[model samples]
Target: MEKYLEIIKNSYSSYWNYLKNSVFMELNWENYFYGLIIISLIVWGLEAIFPWRKNQSLFRKDFWLDTFYMFFNFFLLNLIVLIALSNSASELFNDVLGIVGLSIKNFQLLEINKLPFFTRIFIFFIVVDFVQWWTHRLLHRVEFLWNFHKVHHSVKQMGFAAHLRYHWMEPVVYNSLKYIPLAIIGGFSAKDIAFVHFFNITIGHLNHANINWDYGGLKYIFNNPKMHIWHHSRELPKERKYGVNFGITLSIWDYIFKTNYIPHSGRDIELGFEGDENFPKGFIQQEMYPLGRKD
Candidate 1:
């Protein structure tokens, strides 16, 4: 119990220090703190120069709201709640495994650290994205999960920052689901796969940006704004009522699984789910929305 408390304490202190360095710009070139800002700027700049929805305002509706969602989801809640909970949960899970005479290390399918650096990054990227792809599908297909996911689908207008306008519960779901598969294929540190993680964030931002670029045939391999905008379309096909285009960093999965759908450029499609007119506009209201307690 004391060790558990120490872990909790250290999580808060360590992540707090990270948040301080991030906010103060004291991080190295690869820090996600500055990367978030720089990526948003670069994508927003692209949208401004060559927007798919040309008439959409420079500051689109709910633009600032989505911007706040970016930081809040990325840092604030993690510092205050998620880090401690996840660290403690990991410890408990490891203890449970130890009781079974099996450690996480026992399940290792590959030593990622021993692979070529680029191979390691690529493997981690594909596996992480594939796991998230299924998780994304579940977020739509399952009724209960969809409630938490509605905060993201409630976006009425799409922009770069809108990439991160998801419920706080989402990372809990994503990371929890990612933990086992990643741990099984373990032996790599966050620093080892930082480039892939950064690339994933960049792709996510660009996917939600108001730009239409598919990179010709490369669209088959990578998720692009053109294909992803349809994922936000209010009117899905009758057969695909739950959702479509469930890809994360890669479109190959969607293409392979037949979830990809883009009959035309989705510049003017109505965004958001059914009955979205009543969706809350304020951040607190939206955060509370999934709990059936909009304030």
Candidate 2:
């Protein structure tokens, strides 16, 4: 027990040190570019060999637009939004907690860092996933939120790049909400957050890819392309709940909440918002879309 505690303490110290250095250092664009290229190549290769919809071309309609969305959201817009919001949101949350006399600093006394590494990772993953799942549902059910989210569902064809095709404001909402829970828990290190982020990004791309694999029985557990494809479907049976299946990394939340919807097959289903045939086609127009009508 003493040895395990020591190991955990050392690991925690090392992670914080690394995080501090990373914050002070220049952003590593080389690594970011390399990772993007590698993941794109792997997904593109798999889609080429075993595509779900053989009729769908690699350069389908709005493909370049989706590519631009990917880079813009991942590289430029998300960074600016996250940096602008994180500190202000954190301070605001802490102040609210102070008013209630329930401080996050006190919660940090619980020493969640002493827990096993994998255990911390597991808890972080589940918490973040559940938070995102709720956020996704809100983006669908709330008309205002849905306006920004419509940029994503407007995709008539699915591809790996489509994973990053989201409105800039969408992340501001989700990321802000996600931080509240983490702050309350008070023990998640930067590394824990990074782990969950990596998992979300990897699975998100896979879920949006054109690949055909469904993982058979695991479809009920993890989000897969087949299941997510239906989430983007333009039509659904009258008896089924509209806007169902909003899970981001795990399908279990949808199953528990009774929003899970999976058709026998999604190959023939037409994807996109039903009445949004004229949704803006360019990145700038789409960015301006959620801000309401312009004369």
Candidate 3:
């Protein structure tokens, strides 16, 4: 019986490994960059062609700061993830460290095999977003962590790279917290983890973009650029729209929390922080600003 169980576990491991390799290999670095370029081009095209912020241009200091974040996060931060995974009991550790796989494990309690792949993906993203919503809220409310997250809010302009402007430590803590639950439940495959990262990063970039693209009614299903821009707006009461579009993929949680804010009649919104006027322009300054202010 012990040998049989071992065989089953090995088979499962092999199947998962095959899936990971297949998925990861199919993701071309160039193609991913191309997609980002396309997203950026759209934002730029809208601004140039339709031109919302007449005085605002993409060449501002914030734009480059965001770009730096994008480069480091995609290349350096990802390298760190790979290194972390190389450690012994990496999967188990990831599970215990955060809630990454909790939903998947719990799903097993039901007839999860009957569910479709897209459904599973939906559930995973939703669960992570729910975790993130509260986590993000806490960071802002709590004094210490707020220093780390403030870097994200420092951006005055929206763009594909704004998502990457977040401090590295923020993800270390968030991803670690998430991985614990994921590992415990054995709910997530390696591929699932990668997909979540990719999908969230992509959406995050879109949300930060200044473009006027809206997914229409589908905006209810997912937080689009327009809705997210409102969150970043500097206007009074509008700036407090912070907690509404917390979901990385879906806006369901925002609706549940009564924090949903979607403007009708197309009211013009200002983007960026009004209260904190001392926001720095340099990359190093932004990262260190939180720590400097911590004490």
Candidate 4:
């Protein structure tokens, strides 16, 4: 237990410095602090200029709430998770491997570092996106996971910020499940391609934005608003009660797996699940929502 406590302590200290840098002196080109704001503004601008739903309000319902969610999910909640959870998880997992005289580094089936820099990032993007695709399916098919995901589906009005208006637990599940698959390919640190993170953020915003572009030919390669709104439809397709369009950053998985569906333009389709009107609107209440406590 002392060792675990020590690990948490170190995690806190390390995260503190990183957070301080991100908050203060880390305004460099790669800084997500500024990137988040910039990317959000760009998408919001596009939506305002050419909104698919011309009748919808610019200040849509829960717009500020979803904005808070974007920052919270990206920064505030991340701090707590890194300090108190992920560090211990990494250490414990390594210890378990130690039992068998192995380490995470031992599972490098592809030796990814030897590959070209762009090649590594490209592979990481595809593999990680695929893992997230499967994890998304789990969120819908598994009742327990769906409860957490409901926070996201609670968005009645889709906007750029709606991309991140998910229960914090979603990231925990996404990251945890992606760990092993990434490790198999030498676990290339995501930092190797800072642009990959930015790219996903851009796509995520666009996917949930109030836009109608399906990227024409590239629609299958990348997720877009037209292809993704069907994902948030309140009613499920007759043949797909488990949900559909489980893509995160790319739509290829959905097309390949036969999970893609768009019967029409869906320019003004209803969003949210049944009973989402009862979903908590306050951030605190929503965070506690998956715990089965309405109050």
lDDT of 3: 0.62
Q: Which pairs clash inside model 2?
A: none
Most lDDT-accurate candidate: 1
My TM-score estimates for the predictions, one after another, are 0.96, 0.84, 0.71, 0.94
In order, the Cα lDDT scores of the candidates are 0.88, 0.79, 0.62, 0.87
Q: What is candidate 1's CA lDDT for residue 147? A: 86
Model 1: residues with Cα > 4 Å off, grouped in runs? 293-295
TM-score of 1: 0.96
For model 1, what is the C-alpha lDDT against the true structure? 0.88
Q: Which candidate order results from sorting by TM-score in descending order?
A: 1, 4, 2, 3
For candidate 4, the clash count comes to 0
Give per-residue lDDT, candidate 4, residue 22. Answer: 73
Which parts of model 2 have CA positions greater than 4 angstroms off? 1-33, 96-102, 107-110, 239-241, 293-295
Q: Can you write out model 4's per-residue Cα lDDT over 1-295, one digit (the tens) per residue?
A: 8999998888778776776887786647557787889899999999999899998887899999999999988888877784468778877888999999999888878988888889989998898899899999999988889999999999998899999998988989987887777767864664765778998999999999987588999998898999899999998867898898989999999999999998988887889898888888899999999997453
For residues 40-111, what per-residue lDDT tens digits would candidate 1 score against the true structure?
A: 889899999988888899799988888899999888889978999889988888899999898898988897
